[model samples]
Target: MIKNFLNKLPKKQVKSAESRDGGSLALSSNASTTSRINSASGARSGNVNSLENNSTQNSGVNHGNKLHDPLRSKANGSSPPVPYEALPGFRDVPSAEKQNLFIRKLSMCCVVFDFTDPTKHLNEKDVKRQTLVELVDYVSSANGKFSDVVLQEIVRVVSTNLFRTLSTQPRENKVLEGLDVEEEEPLMDPAWPHLQIVYEFLLRFVTSPETDAKLAKRYVDHSFILRLLDLFDSEDPREREYLKTVLHRIYGKFMVHRPFIRKTINNIFYRFIFETEKHNGIAELLEILGSIINGFALPLKEEHKLFLVRALIPLHKPKCIPMYHQQLTYSITQFVEKDCKLADTVIRGLLKYWPITNSSKEVMFLGELEEVLEATQPPEFQRCMVPLFRQIGRCMSSSHFQVG
Candidate 1:
């Protein structure tokens, strides 16, 4: 009766039933299928049964209830399966189907979850987050050899939503003349973590050796780089840090775009200096520009000289001059080193912005002056000596200092 019942069971359920029964029965019509299933299940169940019996017997003797060799079964033949890369041929030309699937998966990862209704979609949100993390991990490990299609897809998704919560443009006045109302709420998204992941992925993308040229030519445009600069004013320190790294990476990898990056930073500095726009990443941006200036060739371009005069020189006028002092000094020194003739120009610029009331700042200015004087050639120094000593004489006679 039991044999008849087992034989009558559907093929799908038969294997499950056989597993439950320790695979003791031979019920299938195909002899090889029945033999293979029986043998495999018997071995699996035998290991499990031995483990259970050993634990039962050793419960009192072992004191910790420890059984022998938990990995013994896996060692024999039941090892955990290996995970395959979802985007194969990522280093070369991926197949059309794989590319399409990768695009679909990437698009799905961009889905924003409504945190206000987390109760309804908690499970779905978790699954999506995990998928995004895994996908980002895979791409980052590729070392920047992504196909052109993949690079475009990544740039499309990242640019649109990188600053989803924050506006790149200045905030507008929402209140009307006489109406009393509550303040407007900030537009924040719950998926900032995912956004951060994508930013990190982009950092890796730009820094990847194979992808640098591709990114510069195909994906990284002037508008996209400008949008990144606009994000420099983000209130969130974390977002600003990520932006700093990403911008630096872009500057490093895309040599062709370095001029534009400097120009954009110069415009931002113009606003911060002249218009007094509050930008938190000025120090960070200067840090990046310092490296770019270091790499400039001799006989600096007129634009490069103007940047040092207009952008970097005025940077010292801000209250937070100390914050960017090191990077600012390095950039100034780079210019002077590149062309000793610029030494007089830099010193004159420094004297123009030299602090008035703050004695400590005056000392800092003097230190920067000494560096320029040290780097200045004798002939160049002689050219500006009269005006340079005139400024020093004024410093000595100023009311803030008392001569010994």
Candidate 2:
């Protein structure tokens, strides 16, 4: 039947037909539309949907080869710099077919060395670490040819297996037990080079023109970038510094590509500042935010004052803000003079006193009246406060501030 005929056909012939027929090898058409199809066996469908939604589909336009190639060779004897698109050994074999074959081989490697086998990989420690790193590397290089569906499935399998392996490893008892892992030279250290390779692949892929916006969105999705950032501290200083460089390039390239990475960074900043559990972590977080605001403001297009105001509004509400504000108020009142800057900071930080809408003006006016009365000024001041009070009463009666 059809299966027998397909099986009998040459591999190249089958692939050509599959690509032409919009079968397993085909990318979704650039029509900004999607149709559901039940996947064949283990083939993933998610990348098809992702590509259809985020790529040429959403934009409803196809990118032609007409776009100028920045990597193109110059006519004159100009400087010859390496192109990002041209990886080592990528020049001789430029066809998409070759890329696909590379991806398939890497994917098979992950399947062979399963990390989730606790009994085999448990407190075996360094051996397990080295093996898992190799698996991650193999799967991570699957950037160029495999559809998002294929890449996602591979990552899912790798991450789940690695997580299980790491979880089963006996917890280190002494503070310094696992800290000296880098001092010993590796029996192979094959993992290090592979890790760098995979990391580079991911970095390039996410920022590549070939990747659609929808797929690019997944790069920073669910705190993935932050999680990657957290991984740096666990490495040796040199390796950690190298990873930071890679992360810097990734984040920078993302912001340059999409521009919305600033907002993403801002969101991260808010979490670091207002939501993080560790109090000492605040200074480092603030420095990072300050660096972002100062260095990348134009690219970020952030509304600094307005963004702070917006963040403050939620924090002002009593039920919403933490009880720490109340305790801070007490601490400030005990330590600082009545009219001191610390007292002002505490009060301003604690209250969302500014009315969000005109409807709250009456309440604001009442609070103002109490404040003026408490200040207990001279007769002339009292006379000025009285007229202000009358003005507030008139505005309230007339409803001039409200919109219909």
Whole-model lDDT values for every prediction: 0.57, 0.32
Candidate 2 lDDT, 1-404, residue by residue in tens: 22221232222211111111111111111111111111211122123212112112110111223112211111221111211121223234566554554444333223222222222322222222233333333333445444676546444433322221111222221213211212332121112322332343344444344555455445345455555444432322223333433444444444432234335544653564466422212222222333333332222223643444444223333221231233222222322222222223323432334333444443433443344344433543443544455445555675434411
Model 1 CA deviation exceeding 4 Å by range = 1-98, 113-124, 143-145, 165-192, 209-216, 397-404
List TM-scores for all candidates, in order.
Answer: 0.64, 0.32
Point out where model 2 deviates above 4 Å: 1-96, 109-193, 218-220, 232-235, 253-290, 296-404
User: In model 2, what are the clashing residue pairs, if there are any?
Assistant: 32-57
Cα lDDT of model 2 overall?
Answer: 0.32
Per-residue lDDT tens digits for candidate 1, residues 1-404, read: 22322233224312111111111111122222123223222221232112112122110011111112111011111111222123332334455455566676565544433333323434444444455555555554554367777777677656644634454655433323221223543333333444555665676566556575744467788877887888777644445656765676566556566667777889999998888635667766776666566666556778888988888888888765665677788779878988899988888788788766666667678888888788899988888889888878878886665310
Q: Any residue pairs clashing in model 1, and if so which?
A: none
Rate residue 147 of model 2 by lDDT.
Answer: 62
- Strongest candidate by TM-score: 1
Clash count, one per candidate: 0, 1
**Which stretch of 10 consecutive residues in model 1 shows the poorest summed lDDT?**
57-66
